[model samples]
Target chain A: MQSSIKQWQDWIGGIAAQGKFVGTNRLGFEGKTLKPNQVISDGPYAEVKEMVGGYLLVKADGIDDAMKLAEACPILQIGGHVEVRNVIPMSR
Target chain B: MNEKTLIQQLFKSEYRKIVSVLCKLFGAHHIETAEDIANDTFLLASETWGVKGLPENPTAWLYTVAKNKTKDYFKRRHIFSGKIVSELKYSQLNSESFEMDLSEENSKDSQLKMIFVLCNPLNPTESQIALALRILCGFGIDEIAVAFLTNKETINKRLFRAKEKMRMANIEMELPNSSEIHSRLETVLSTLYLLFNEGYHSSSQHSPLRKELCLEAMRLNYFLIENEATNQPMVNALMALMCFHASRFEARINAFGQAILYDEQDRTLWDEELIAKGNYFLIESAKGNEISKYHIEASIAYWHCTATAHNGKWEHILQLYNQLLQIEYSPITALNRTYALSKVQGNERAIEEAMKLQLNENHFYHCLLGKLHSEQNPKKAMECYEKALILATSSSDKRTIQNHLKKLR
Candidate 1:
């Protein structure tokens, strides 16, 4: 598992060398789950399939192009998947 | 060259100019749009040039494509007649024909403005260097990371923070007034100097050295000399310094990417043409009364460019080092002075001076001590070399210290 993680890092590093990398973030396990009013808890709960590990931002042309990039990500090899989103830029 | 290689070269040389001009035409807020259009122009060139067998004037071809694409964008979005018309000159707007003038003078002005904008005081020192490398020099993040001896992450963060600040402040893409040029010019020159030094003494193991960065720095400095406001004695001094340093690039690195110390470098391999240019600039730098640290450093470099152990060379170098230390008392300069002193006075006196400097933690300090102690005190020299070897981070620097240790054995 450690070796595979190293491999994943190398793959991401390769993309970075090409100057296409934007950035990434690391998520905390104790993310707050908020509801209406004063209801807040540490229960986005690992039981659900909707938990996010993190996000990797990159420069790509379109949805299909970004999808292609995500396909090379190593998360899927460990039973994890990627979710790509388009960030709508706000007007200045 | 192959079509792809030619296109890539053009992209490196002309990309920044096009982006700068476009960013000026449009506002600073639309810099991303300008970058996108420029990238598209390059992409189109890459796609079509292979089939068309290359254009006679590739740079002109790129400008034409960018202008036409920009015109099309304005027509399609309907913002040109409303937004851009107000920002641009009324004569240009009313003609119904908008031209992106990319004449040499305009391109030079845009690049000069970019240098000032990148070196704005709002940005931190590191961010200013990173922005200049990216915006004016057309360097990729990877190249910049290698140049600075840091990772891509750090360079990325610096660039992002700088761009964000630029956006918030809405820094104009135009030259500063004459009153503000002196202080701003100092920052610009220092940034260029750092860029040149990175190329001259690069820590990257793969490429080891980057002559391209050095050349780019010199090329930009030449632009300052061309303009009246920026043509100061210090600018000429910096140019002379770069030329002198660049003249010996061919002899500085070996085939195995090992650094060859200055004394051991092949004098014949040094570029005579560049040395002559350095001499010219050094003389030109003597015009004004101002004697900057650059002038003193350039004088030292000029002595080195002679590449001969003439009668008074070491004495002259020591004098210049003394002057430089008086002006800017950096440990690095002091470390260098000990060597020149060793030549002028004696090894024992030089060693005494070296030991007085509180640079015990610096690898180069120990390395110099190791050299000083080699003949008289072999055991002390061995210990100094060992310390240097342990402290050195880069493989090349470690290898250099290791070589000294090997000689002692």
Candidate 2:
């Protein structure tokens, strides 16, 4: 599963290398990571399991390229699945 | 887009969707654990993707992380007992089929069921609806606190107590039986009405109109309409009333975020489409011989919406209020009917009925009495206004009554 996710990440990273992707990670686990603008806290016996696993965002030319990149995701090797959805464009 | 804004937007849309999808995979009973894992997955995604640059399909990447997190949680939970581990493995296979069956329609149905479960009468009155709105509808405690005219600490306590009751009762996620549906539907309708009214009469200066609350109420009402057991006349009537009131939301408040009296509101600003929809629902609600308080209230509001002028027909409104009073003679109804009487039969008759009732010494009742007395005896009106000001909950309401007193002065 880890390899599948890694492969998928590499595929996505390759896309980014080609200037076809932009990535971001949403920090969901509150105390796990020190957020860019957040202050660090002292030890409160933090739980490792509660830590955030992080994410990747990729912008592609079309759905096909996105799928092709997702096919190599390391998560599938560890018996996990990926969910693909189109982002709705914001009207500015 | 900038990295921070892009990440924020992506997380906002995907977080709920991913959590919802995973909850089904890991039984609804294990929702808290599922939520924790989903949170962990997003954190993982943030770290990995931020430095590596975004993946081709960000949603897919997040899902992958979430699924792995789910597996880890199950594995840990089953670590103590071998028998539980085997059972977990069995369920893991079953979950694959479950994931395949998770259609859009099913998800919506699940959400609707969650709403009902939250509003269950078996739960404590104080926090049942509030907790449900928070968990099921994503409303924050602060938002609910403002709506209920209370502080966040009280709201939080209520929510905590509610969740404890749910856990103690071992409340399962399922629809109520046909026999119990009516009572359950009553609770559901009340919650939805409460939600809509908060949006319709918002107290917040920052966001005077919460369209989210209105839309959620409408959506839940639609869900009720879809279900055979809940499709009653009262439900339809309440929905119609919500639509009619929501239609006038745009004109209900001024640009400065101050309350705009119905008389001063611009009728042209109303959403005609929603009014037409409300009219259609009102007709549907009136099909049967039975009449509910909702039916009467909706009918009254419908007339107000259709009236060509502000003072078009107080007699019709008075008649509807009389019907409403017969069906449900609450203090609020008495107060409202008094206002309609003041409009139609003159201040004397209105004052006579208003004085008969023992209102909770609230500002609204005093305000009503103040307005009724203002025409005949300005001194009495001034006295009522002062009483109302003392009882007033908000500065805005006090200011309104003060302005009325100023007219007399």
Candidate 3:
């Protein structure tokens, strides 16, 4: 656990050094999910086998640049994969 | 044997001999030097043997190559011109200084001493095992890394740190003195036992690497039993324990890699040869007055091998467990004993002891609880099985627990 967090720090710090780091959040195991009709339950992937461990936000010139950052992610070391996507900003 | 097999065998057997002989001659501080010479010798042997076919006497050829390499090492390091210059006159120097006499007795002495040196109580147990694997077992760093389920960098760092610790201690590559032999021997035996169990008790028990680990531990233990000074009854007893466990290696795991319970296993799969060997060692171990924990555990393992599920077997095992707890009381042992207790006495009695253990975090404890509760309380047994399923992280273990739960339903 400590190693992975240290890995995350190095990864994020690498992007930050390149002026591409925007933000990130390590989604913890504990959370709550509010369903329809005010029914409360466990968060997110409680029933699903797959989980979104965390998310990284980065600024890139294009999808190709963002894909490069995703390819360098440490999660890939243990058979985990990363999905790179461009965020659509909502205009107010 | 074929050329490749011959090289492989020599690598496994002679690599340790050459390294140990070099370290003994040059002192333990030059362990890396010894290892380097040995590694180079093997690489050369493989390349040479691949083209030329097996030599008439491969061991002798390897020794000759190693001796020359040792002389070259001294020459390259300029030790003749530097440190030993005054002591080494031109007339006094000869090939005797570079002779790699890996005679059976000589290599055995070096290796036996090497085990004691590596098991120096000053160093941590992990370091001791890692160093023993590299120095004594001739395992490559990548092989050790895979055996340990870690990366190469981590293993490299561990070996580097361990060698540094040994250097700081300046431990001699020899047997401990009489005053300290007992404690030192105990450390050596325990380290070997841990190495064996690391393979035997691993969740991935079916892996060939795990079995290889067990055999390496046995091979080292064999060295101890061969030597006169270290051939105590405890050593033989530990050997017997391993032999008995390994005899059932085939039967313990099915084709699908799931564990087969003792009663459920095919009796034909148990190796008769290993059982006989275990009996021989058990008899050998009986000569001494000492009744170590190894003695008790070996006897317990023997009963498991010799007989099927029956009162006489469990009764003997249960009695041994009682004595084992007296000698060394571990929670896992206590939990293990409950299964035999359940067999000989009854579920109620075993359940009483199991409840006292309160091994809340252990899946095996709940597995036992499920077994104990099955006949009388199916619902409780199902609950226990569910708890075990939740607690077990291994897919094989989870599958086994689910099977038990399915039966209860």
| Tens-digit per-residue lDDT, A14-51, candidate 3 | 45434466677878888888889998887777788778
How many angstroms is residue B227 displaced in model 1 relative to the true structure, after the best TM-score fit? 2.1
lDDT of each: 0.81, 0.68, 0.80
Off by over 4 Å in 2: A1-92, B1-28, B41-64, B79-101, B140-157, B226-229, B287-289, B309-312
In candidate 3, stretches whose alpha carbon ends up further than 4 angstroms from where it belongs are A1-92, B51-53, B80-97, B309-311
Q: What is the lDDT of candidate 3?
A: 0.80
Cα TM-score of candidate 3: 0.77
Candidate 2's displacement at residue B105, Å, is 3.0
Q: What's the TM-score of chain B for every model shown?
A: 0.92, 0.83, 0.93
Residue lDDT tens for model 1, A21-72: 5776767777777879988877677457677887877767788867866776
Of candidate 3 chain B, the 10-residue stretch with the lowest lDDT total is B84-93
Look at candidate 1 and tell me the lDDT of residue B240: 97
Compute the lDDT of residue A70 as modeled in candidate 2: 71
Q: Taking the tens digit of each residue's C-alpha lDDT, what string does model 2 give over A1-92?
A: 65444334334433343344456454443443354679555433363433334455666657776676677556566665666666887985
Query: Each model's interface RMSD (Å)?
Result: 19.8, 31.3, 24.8
